[model samples]
Target: MVLGAVVLWELLAAFLERTMDESVYEYLDFVDATDSRIPRRSTRAPGLAKALSLLRGDGRALLFAGTVFLVGAAGSAGHNFLLWQLQDQGSSGLLMGLWVGLGPLAELALHPLRGQLLRALPGCGLELLSLAVLAAQLLSYSLLRAPWAALPVQALSGLSSGALRWRLQGTVGDVATPGSERALLALLGGLCAAGAGLGGLGGGFVLQRFGLALLLQASCAGLGLWILFVLIVRSRLPRRRKINYSRLLAAESSEMSDSEEENEDWLVKAMRDESFNRNWIQQHGIK
Candidate 1:
């Protein structure tokens, strides 16, 4: 059923891609903006096809999807779990939403840095740096005494989310191409969405069982556990067989929110140039 619906949707999208008044490039731009991980492939057929390919390719596709799903699950577990606990921590509804929204807001401040980081470093290094940032955010939660202090933590969410969002696409794009890859990509994306939702639920339940402070303490513990998982599972993964840093970056750039993408474009351009990126990365030791 899942695969069938995707085929139907892909057929519909392909028909539209071919016949729509909008040119395919423009239509692709819409898709890139709407779901950056949708891949800038010339067509939507790959969303399903790639998954099929992955299955045929050493049985690695499903493993790749499942592995990332765990990471996504871990990520959602941390975020949703924390958000729920924070919301229940003696705050008003407005304050709760504002606080929860802070993670993306945090991204607003650090995206430039992340783009630079991705451009200069090995993929493992990028993953480590991103993980480090999230760990710091979790550390903040552990140390925070007042609810207001938690606002700063949300800023980290921006980086956390931005990194995950783009990396998710780049990862999917890296493995599943040939246009028909969209099925796998979309399914992976869908899993990420589902993982985050489940993470939220699990986080809330953990808090209910352990109480807020204990919940947070456990959350921190989980982040550490995830760090270990990254070291073991992520750091050791092979490089993308055909790593297109430029294309990978575009996959990421296209996914940025319109305003956010606009904000990041200058940075993207600067980083893409060899001289500019070298100096920039050197100044920050981004690698």
Candidate 2:
């Protein structure tokens, strides 16, 4: 269904020739002095070396990565317990579908307003708020007797998910090098996946050994640890600086142009050298 939606959107967009607003780019831009002009090279599939380099070079980046990993881990743990709770409650398939779908829909409904919200609150604030909401949702799941009661909670849960996603994207813009966004995104995604796997493994053990209530409680504690990390990092970081995105855009354009010119010059030089070698060989009666 996601693939179908992507294809449908692409077809419609091509038919409409709809131009995106400049504000989209403004929201998505990241700047770094050490970044290279060869975006295609930087944006290639990230390797272990790149991840190591990123972690070893920047302590703050390491903290951010750790936070993401913890969040993913806790979320997956909560999810396992949530499924178990719903199953125990004998939730109907249709009701389960509604519970699952409504949250992302609520999130999608709020995307247009995310920009204004970010202006009013820092990304960390949004992240903290999302964590708070997730905590509430888990509490609801723990307390609510009926599975249907958890349906409305899913909407708010979706809102938290959306907020976190928006904050993460903004973090990428804030921290990623201009040309390395794709690679950085890939690295973060892998970490989240790994964390989720670990969480799932632990959650299953806890559920089988203890019970569902204990699992939910443990997930809450995990989220608390994640919140602590976020708070510590947020407190340490300097005040947010306003970025001049227009200047960054111009700089990126100029950088791309210079890189292309350099590549062309290299090609020309290589051709000239090859021709000179051929001529010299003919004159000297060499093969």
Candidate 3:
């Protein structure tokens, strides 16, 4: 199945490359603000130095990293033990497969509404929603004695994980300095990796010492902490004036069409125009 998926992805990528050359080039041009054909960091600094700068200078980036680390740790500790929990209840392979498969299906079902949700909710609201859903699922799993009881609960993971990732990516993008996105992403990835690794290693010992029920409860507590962190961070963010999302979308679409007709990308133009970027930040309330 994995191999087939890989093959399908390759085919689709090749087809897009072949048939949508101009559109692909336009997107590439938009992302490649430097137009050097190389996506180098604007600062041209070493990775370690850039990371240190973010830690020392960018409070929002630091807060984002800390929040993601806690999320990774809680996710790893709780999720890795889920299969074991089912097995302890004598779940069969078919039941386990159903439990796992339904999650991705639920996540896929939510994709069509993803843009609308993002437009409606603040970034912090999405994170809080993700945490709340995860906490509820963990609580349910902790209370369940029958394997079948846990099957429907698995879908919450799909929803929570999807929302969390979507909000996280947007938060990172908003906080990252122009042309420094790659470096910041690399750094965030490293922190999350470390957190996950530590969580997995520590979780086994915790399960042995505290048992499954306690471990699941602890996971819920961790998620609660994450919710608090998000709230605190949100409080610090600048307040955005209310704007009509539908109107904003229309204006952006019109701007895109006008820019395309002028042989320019809106983003590239924004990168060149200080006032444009400033107005954008002010309008969007991007701190």
Candidate 4:
């Protein structure tokens, strides 16, 4: 059904662009509406004349779509759980974003090898690291009376989260082959959406019934189970090569080392061009 909708959207978007000369956002709206009303199965009809929309097939469009996708999910997660802390801890949606952004910040050391390392490692490894931190953070969150002291725990959760997230996506992509990629990606996306939807529901339930302490304890234990599952089951996924993070960033800089000038040149260039270095500075502002 989704695939058929994609095809229909492609056709309608093509025709609408040619006749109405619409914007991509307009096309998006039309397609969204169409998606809502898409019946079981019925097709045939090329629609109107073709028009090459600016946003449809462009190379940069894919990048934009991917970014929009991730940001939407991340934003939703923040609004659901962390935003609730505002009543007691003065935590807002923005605060949650700021704090969780820390884990990704800490992963600066692992950025270059993200895809490579994820493909090499088990999904369980990332899940375990994430759950361990999440468990600890949640425990601290419930234990501390001081909200300011607890805020750093959220940041720690974020750092661990960032690494786990990056690894998860990479591993999921790696798990599905060319033959099954589309269905696998769709399944993965649906699972994510389902989880988020459940989280929204479950989070509210926790706040209402069990209270913070019980909720935190449950969250910790739940994540701990995730760690166990990953360690036992996901660790056995098919792998082409083994990855070693420590070896990649070696301390024995005795052989085939770059000159001081070359190293300094790269460092300076990176510092000048990098823009994502804001998360660290933004985190403290949340508390």
| Model 4 C-alpha lDDT per residue in residues 1-287, reported as the tens digit of each score | 99999999999998976567446434654565577786322431211111112223333322222332332343333445544554466656665666656545656755676666555655345545655765676667667664456456655644455655675466435444322333434444554576656655676677688775676667666666645654554335444566776776674353336566688899998886664456655766753
- Give the candidate number with the greatest lDDT: 3
The residue ranges of model 4 lying beyond 4 angstroms of the native Cα positions read: 1-79, 90-123, 157-159, 234-287
> What is the lDDT, from 0 to 100, of the residue 18 in candidate 4?
58
User: Can you rank all candidates by lDDT, best first?
Assistant: 3, 2, 1, 4
CA RMSD of each candidate after superposition: 20.4, 16.2, 16.2, 24.1
**Per-residue lDDT of candidate 1, residues 187-273 (tens digit):** 777776776677667766866787555555555566566567656765455644767899988887777766696778977876679
Model 1, residue 49: distance off in Å is: 6.2
Candidate lDDT values, in order? 0.63, 0.75, 0.77, 0.53
What ranking of all candidate models by TM-score puts the best one first? 3, 2, 1, 4
lDDT of 3 by residue, 160-221 (tens): 87887788688767766654565677788888788888888888899999987887789888
lDDT of 2 by residue, 177-214 (tens): 54456567778888889988998898789879997677
User: Which portions of model 2 show Cα errors greater than 4 Å?
Assistant: 1-48, 55-60, 238-287
TM-scores for all candidates? Answer: 0.56, 0.65, 0.67, 0.47
Best by TM-score: 3
Cα lDDT of candidate 4 equals 0.53
* Model 3 segments more than 4 A misplaced: 1-43, 236-287
